[model samples]
Target: MRLTNNLLFFFILILSLYSQPVQAQSCQELETWTRLVEHEFPSVESKSVRSGSLIYNSIRFNLLSDKYFIPVFGKPFEKVGKLKKFSIKVKLTKCKKKPKFPVSKRLDWYMWGVFSQERAYNDAVKEVVLLRQLRNELPSILTKINSPMVTNDDLEDFAKIVETKFQRLLPSEINKLEKAIEKQYTIASKNQLTLAINSLKKEEASFDKLMIISKFKTDNELLLKKLDQDTRHNFFKKLAYLKTKTISELVELEEMLLPNISAVTFQDYAAINTIIDRFTTNWYPYSNLPRVEKLRNYYFELKTLLIAVNHREVIQQIINTNTLQGFKNTQEAIFKYTFSSDQIILDIKSAIVLKYRQLQLLLRIASDEVQSKSYSMATRKKLLNSVKQIQKYERVSIEGKNLINRALHKSQVLCNYIMLEELKKITEPFLSIEKKTIGDLNRLKVKIIDFKNKYKTCDGEVYDGCIKAMEGIEKNYK
Candidate 1:
């Protein structure tokens, strides 16, 4: 009976040891105890069991104690083997009690062993609920931020969330998320830039093309500053290629339009001038190009052509002038200030020579009329006036003066002959003196003989005899 009582006491003591507060032992010490159990008991297998009855629980290791030997005094000291096995429950309690830092995997397992099945299931439910909440909210936080392209503002918002709310996420994990977002952003931005560059190809106007390219350059510069260095590299290279291609297209367009400048008429002066100015300004970088140079040359040539056209108009107006002096003044002005092209100058010179030839022909025709003896005094006088009128424009050519002077001399000679004939007709009535006194008879015979003799030598002295005979008749008759 005393032995039974002592056994009962010993069992109660073991129970008391098992129920001791877990704070008395460190987690490492508890882990060491579990290891010792495994090492010492070869045949006893340990089963881990966890409890979650409360917020904090113990880890229980169910171990089967192996059959052990007992010492007994029978005749002599002897060893006896106990055939019975005992189930032992080892508890590592409070292991998961709110730790200051994260628990090690082994320590976590030790703590988890203590939870009850119901408590573990409740804990799982809580975790699953929390995971579901995070999953649902995560997409809203990440995906809703600038659907395809994430801006600096969106990135800033993400940074703020990471700093304030997602601080628990590892830097590597956060970096992966950011990279994903940035990839989308890069793709979207690249698409936009590519589309814009492609749109530029359709542009027809030089000014509009330059304006769009200029603006795009500025916007791309600003956008590049926001992108990471790695992102910037591909974007820069690709966009630069696109930019170069667009600029090349613009240059080609300008080259294509260059012929229009040469074909431009006077009516297109203002519009063409604007084109020239724009090309000079925008294409300055490519000014060394042959096509660009041609554009420049064509512009100035157009200006020169304009001057020549206006000069030709002036020349045309002058050609209609009645006097040579008007043409002379205009031609002088053209030579000094207006004339530019070789073609126009040659044309104007030819026109002037033609006018000179026409005037010379008229003078020659009038001069030929003076040689005709059938011409009346009135007709001879009219010829003299026509020759004198042409003489006014004698400066039209070098040969004009000589032609005019010869024509003037011929017309004057004809006038003299006609005047001589007129004077002879006036004297015919006086030549036969039927009722004459001796002095009158002598005067009449002298007058008739003198008039006849002078008229015959009129051509040698430029008709001086006609002038003298007229003067004597007027003096004697008066």
Candidate 2:
């Protein structure tokens, strides 16, 4: 009895140790920020401590006064104060450590640093714009100084040099100057200059294929709505005509116009190419032209194609073939043609489905071997690792994760159904040899019925329920 008691005690101790939860490390930076906020904003009430499976390790706090709250990674915190009216301050330090100065003082120091840097950038932009305006007024200033007429050719040459020098500055630097000019003057040139600056910003943001696809679809829809059918058709026709025409002919036509025709229509021609690529690769072939069945279908196809080409194996293959060096040439030829986001998304979904099937295959093989007690440790490890890798690919936003989880559950249910059916098949032969073991049959019948009821609750079509049910059965049988 004492020996049994000691063994039981040991087992309980082991269980206790295993059940203890692991604590996440605190974020020193976030703690420091929190401390600073508490010190500076005494009236701001401290909220209840929020805990989850993942704890906040650290966070940077921008004290906008009365708006402070917990922040998750990658998400902007709630705005507490108006930027124009209020002076916002932030300070960073190691959590739980005593600083040389008060938190308020530290915050003030950092705020000054930030404000000074912003002032310096604004000052530089103002200087550039002032220089540009002075340069533009140079010919007039020179003529005024001489008190005689300056030749048009000399004035034009001086103006060209000034413009050339202005163009030499980076786009960002030019944008800064433009913003400074807009802030100082309320003229129409300011608005036009700001619009040009914003266009460059948009260009930088639209690099992602998904983002580009979304913008293209949005812009295309807007254009279609804005223009008449005849105008749209003519625009497309001109683009097609230009594609077939010689470069020299296009250049000659461009030269005939005061503002180059090519410059005005370049974006239109590029959009046409995108449309052509989408039709060819993503759209269903109808009379040798691409036709989309639905908007959703189009987006899905495009996303899928992009994901497929972006796969590690395909990228490695491209690198091995030394084709990546031709990126400059390929980018123009490939992306010149537009594809629908709907089509791309569809293609990505298709690839995911394929991956899901592969996982299912592995699961089935593993299950069969487990049932037979024939799978080696190495094989089991490999199967588990593959499942883990597939699970990583399944990671998305919380909503997306839920969808994937539902899909996995459905798959599991289907797997359980198959397993139960297989078990029934295997048991059929044993039934005739087991009049004495009728209790086993009764238990098996109860298990099967229980599984069916559980599956119904889980939406019988879902595989995850079936899988879970099958696992229960396996455990019970073992």
Candidate 3:
């Protein structure tokens, strides 16, 4: 009976412990604690992020799927240095009707968390700040570098920054950035070119300036080619204007040198030719410009003047030759030149005629000497040879041929006279023989016959005198 009573008492005590009330959990409490889980996205730092379940206060709590702990682990309390903890309360509740399962126990429980929702929000704020910085800084860099002094390298550096530093931006934003950079670069480059051109304009127009212009042209070939037609013309016009000024000065120098061309030294002649060559080669491309056209006119005029001067020199040389052959050659050479001034040709022809007249006078004086029997046989023969040389000259005018022929005939007559006089002298020695020997008479007759035969074509007075003298010798010998 004592054992039965003790078992009943123990059973009564167990029943009381089993019947204790358990508190029910609320959805609001679950939500408030669940909010502590972080929404961590994938990244380089996220890859190295510590993972797995949490062990806090010696209790193992598995992380829900797709959730992660923050990198710094748990958040701390706002005012205190203690780690922040979130707790959810579970309370027991009776069903309004029948329960699905009998309550086995009763208790009020708590679940704790140390979590936050600020990390994702903070990352978003940083992104917005970075976007603003890129948008503002790129244009700022471009604005700072848009001066006339900016180099291509500076523009290129900005381009490199756009490519490298803005990789995190959206593709659309990156494209806009690239376009902005390109536009700014163009403006900057144009400013630089304009400034350089203005500086060039202030310089004196000289060969040195031309060389610098040529170098500038070569260096900025692409930029210059891309200019609009009017702008291009204006650009080259300034260069052409400078060149025109230089060419005008050169033309003045050439005018100053023109008077000396007749006696120009070899060095001076070469310099003139060099200047002429540059007139053709070193001019700018704005040919339609009025100043350039004026320069071209000056070049042509100078060329014409030089040609006329050279023609005059040639004509003077021909006159100085003092020979009909030289005059004939001058005529032929003149045919090859396209005379810019007809007066030049007319002057040369007139000078040649005057020279011919002078030569004719000289020949007439020699003829007078021959007709008067003033020169020896050798001198007469020399005059005849000179006349014959003139006759043989190629391409003489008909008048010149007639004059040469007349001179030749007069010279021949003179030579014939000298020959006849010498023959008369030879006969005189034989004519002086006192008495007539058969041999002397035979010699005188033979001489007369031979002289008559040799003088068959001769009709001049000297030939008649020679025949009469031989007849006298023949009569004396008889």
Candidate 4:
């Protein structure tokens, strides 16, 4: 009777534990970790986001689901030597229309992400990177990092690679945490990227459709909504296609009928020519015509501004000011990223970025000398640039050393000595590279310095030629 009672009590206890909600659990400590990085979703109520499709909305309580994306990590992720699965998520937001899922019957623009083995692994890596970055920078940013010699992105990328590799290896510490029998069932590493991006085709179609629909204003919106989903989708697609065709035809009509219809500003002329060029490469979607409206405004704005400024100065300002428009980096569907498996590439990339910063400094100084105008000064500045380049490579060796040291320090926190010792094997080849680079840099510096000291005023003829040209001009004038 006592054994039966005890067993009954145990069964009830297990059932109660299983039924407990995640929100009810003591998850405060786990929630405190802000290191988990994932795509930020837009406000759920926003018209743009409300219309997009969602894939993982139902998995909130599953133990293996992304609901637990936070500071608290499973021990299995860090202990496994071979990372069998890596997860990737792509989330897009604020879209034109929300399509019902099971993608085949869905309307345009709402893309559902299906699992790709490569995608999953890569997405997981993004978290690994974010965690590493926060580990290094959050502390430093709170205090101060004196003009960090390395770019934050470079160091963070390297740090993630190191941490991820260490995580992959079944370390002694993980073995200590889990018994051998339980290891078979534990899911250690997983990717938790939640991408909101639907389909590019659908997004483009909806945005186009909205523009065409807007011409009707409030009158037709209700009528359009009353149409069936497929009817509305086809109507929009056909309308957008016709709009694009009409614009192309109008451009041709103007060229044929009124090729010289009132001369335009130089700015307007240039912008028109650019539009012509765009027509060749662009898909000529309905959105393309709207871009020209802003550019034409620029033409008028420049013309209006020119009323106050001289043509020479205005032209100089326009020509000399190079506009390198910034673009968001197109992250790959799956980037060919180096995993924890290759430390050498990550190490080299970090060192190169640090050294590249030094080169940029030298270039800036050289640019300053160019603006000042002195032939001898220009040569001397360039010679100094060569010296800096040598010094930059010298620093590369130092950066490599620092990278190794940082890796060791971070590893020590999560791994036992035996696990770390195994990691050291991967880095052994990199040590020789560091030593070789340092030695070569030292030798090259001496040769470069000797060359700089030997550099003479070889630009004297340039000065003499300018003086002779000035005298000839005066003589001819007199």
Candidate 5:
């Protein structure tokens, strides 16, 4: 009867406390809470449970001063495995209500360095979650920041605000994280450097080939040739354009590295420049030839012949001795032309055409292997040299053709300069014969273009057609 009366009174008291609304604040009394559990609770224990499960319990409190300490229990001991209660004496302080989330700039100042140095395990994990959430949000916030500079001072304030809302990090963990970030940056830098080196090498090769094929080495004799005012102007204008192209290419190759100055060094730039200087020289300008389909067709045939002959030579060498002596002999044969100083330049031009053809064949087969990045450096270099030689021959052959055409054009122009004494002696004006000769030469050029497009060689069909077409053209004037 007495127990029943006491239970009724206790029930009434719990109902009275439960009627009030709970208001969260900096500190609150613990006694105002009503019990949810109907049964007795297990006590905090030091010993291993018979069930082999572990449990932890916590109670929080407000600090006694602006900065203060209170004793709180810590971890358990291993010996005896008995249930034991402990009193841990350590400094414990309250954090500034863990600051309202999505804290403003002003709120950050209020929370700075206000949290204690220690954390309960659960609280530390919550702090880490809070930090990560803020870090994720920072990018957008940083973008919106109105300051001319989001200075280091602004960053420091942000750090303090974040730190005070979380448990303190140990020194060792901070060191490990810094090292990991540094390692990532280092790896990225090295990859960038390697790609740059390879791309630069390829670009250098292209520029080098341009110089090798270019006719910047034109002799004084050609430069000193008497040209009309219009011809002289055209020649100088073309030369200027060629020089501009060379400068543009150099600027482009050097500009590729400007963005990577922090990662690549001056010494690396110097090495690249030295390589560029070595491979390319100057391009010889082509004369403003008339746009004739027959002439262009012949040029295509010339290119075809260059490639086919080179391929045949390579096969022959492989089948022959397959020895270095054979290669030496082949090289000797390519440069075998003998010419006297007073000899026609046409005779000397033939040797270059032969060498160009051989190199063209080598490049046709090897270019794919080089670009695939599967060949040795030495192999790629040899391939590039062949391409350079091919370009040289192309330029040389065109130059030869232009020189012959120019001589023919000059014969017609020279009649205007002939004096009265020489002019009266001739039965016909020299210009008349030269005009007829140019028409005959143009006809021969057309036949040459038509023949080679099908036959693709200067011999056989080319020889027979050429002899038949040109017999009367040269004999009348000679």
Candidate 6:
């Protein structure tokens, strides 16, 4: 009789804990804020509002604002102009429920959102600063680099090669070269007396290289004169025409000898200096600038894609892990308040776990879209193969697996999003490809629906259905 009484007491205690109700959001502050916003921004329209199980109450608003400005004149002549402003109105209904979540938890979410936005904006500013610095440094560096001294005959031949090979380079390339040369000359002229000795040295080194390569050493001065007469436009045109092999060979020679050449060894200095000079005059103006810029842009694009991919992966991981942990934490905390059965806690835990798995799958799909955008076909194929090798680790319950399928389906849609943006960049005039991409995305949506339906049919609320779906979807990627 005593043992039975003890068991009955324990059972009732558990029931009492499990039966407690969850606290709801406090409506007062939210209602006040909504009213204030509506009053201040009268033109904004609030379409929907919802408070989640968590602390945040999200309100969607469409806002329209009008700008008013006055033109001012320094002198007596200018007339002021008036502009009309239009605004759209949105309103949020006041919430009645009092939020149960702690103020600290609510504050954390708000702060995180603001911090994330600020960090992204700061990073963008840094990139722009770096780009500007690189642009500014380019011209002076080019001038410091010396060009190879070539004979009149060689110049004529090189010019002909440029005309034939680099026909695609526009006249603007020559204009840029002229501007660089003029800038260098202007700077040198400002400090002419101080620069005279260094200029002589440079000229002598250039002349010596010409002498070494020239078949007619006696006509050195004449060759130098003729070369100087050649316009920067014509010089760059010739440079653009040089074969890739010639440029590579020149760069190789300069790299090997540049370190050993000192002012004392005039011949070696001249030889290496000439190659460096050629690289600046020919390579910089024609090939190096364009190629480097193109590669940099490509790298920037790749980095951006990676950032988006990484963000999705990180957020998904956090959401999945944190949500699962949150569920566990909630159950433990609420055990004192709710006297529900162990079965109820177990069911909630299982639901939370399944939700996490679903979220993980969704994130994986989003990541895949970024990979597809940045990676080559062969690389993507290899990556997919690697994923297949790890399939066993990813397998989960039927519902979990179904969630994975849905995630993978969503990933296909994400791919379309990335591809659409990529195509816009590649296609000069935007092609009518949006429809095709949209169709592909729609198919993914249909697949997600199917996955959800199939997931619902699993026998147990938290069975092997999720795992099976995950495995099936993994196979598709492979």
Candidates' C-alpha lDDT = 0.52, 0.39, 0.52, 0.34, 0.35, 0.35
True-structure RMSD, every candidate: 23.4, 40.1, 18.8, 40.5, 29.0, 50.6
Judge candidate 3 against the unseen true structure and give its global Cα lDDT, from 0 to 1: 0.52
Q: Is candidate 3 or candidate 5 better by TM-score?
A: 3
> By summed lDDT, which 10 consecutive residues of candidate 3 come out lowest?
101-110
Residue-wise C-alpha lDDT for candidate 6, range 279-321, written one tens digit per residue: 4454343334445344334323332333233433423333444
- lDDT digits (tens) for residues 1-478 of candidate 4: 9999999997886555444433212233222221111112223223343232331221111112223333233332223223111111111121112242212112112223322244543544454444444444433432222222323333345445434432322233223223321221111100000011112223433333444434632444544554556755655575556456545554554345333423444334444444444533333343256543443344334333322233333323332322212100111100111132334434433543454455454444444433534434344445454444545455434433443344333323222332233324323433345335555445444443433343322224433443344334334333
Clashes of 3: 6
Looking at candidate 5, the ten consecutive residues that score lowest on lDDT are 84-93
lDDT of 2 by residue, 300-335 (tens): 344334434554443223222213234334333333
lDDT of 4 at 21: 33
Give the per-residue Cα lDDT of candidate 1 at 328.
70
Query: What is the alpha-carbon lDDT of model 5 when measured against the actual structure?
Result: 0.35
lDDT of 3 by residue, 299-328 (tens): 445444544566666555666554667767
Worst lDDT run of 10 residues, candidate 1, spans 68-77
Question: Backbone clashes in each candidate structure, one number apiece?
Answer: 12, 42, 6, 24, 9, 45
Q: Residue 378 CA error for candidate 3 (Å)?
A: 31
Error of 1 at 455 (Å): 60
lDDT of 1: 0.52
Q: How well is each residue in 1-478 modelled by candidate 5, as lDDT tens digits?
A: 9999999997885554344322221112211110111011233222322221212111111111111111111221111111111101100112123333221221212222223222332343354444445445545544433233433334445445434532222223233333433343333333333343334334543445444324432532233243445645654565455545554565455446434432433224334334323322221132222222233333333323333345444434433432345545643443222122323223333443464455444434343333534323344444444444544543333433443344333322332222222223322343345456666556555553554352332234434544444444435444
Candidate 5, TM-score vs. the true structure? Answer: 0.18
> How high is each candidate's TM-score?
0.35, 0.18, 0.35, 0.16, 0.18, 0.13
Candidate 6: lDDT of 383?
38
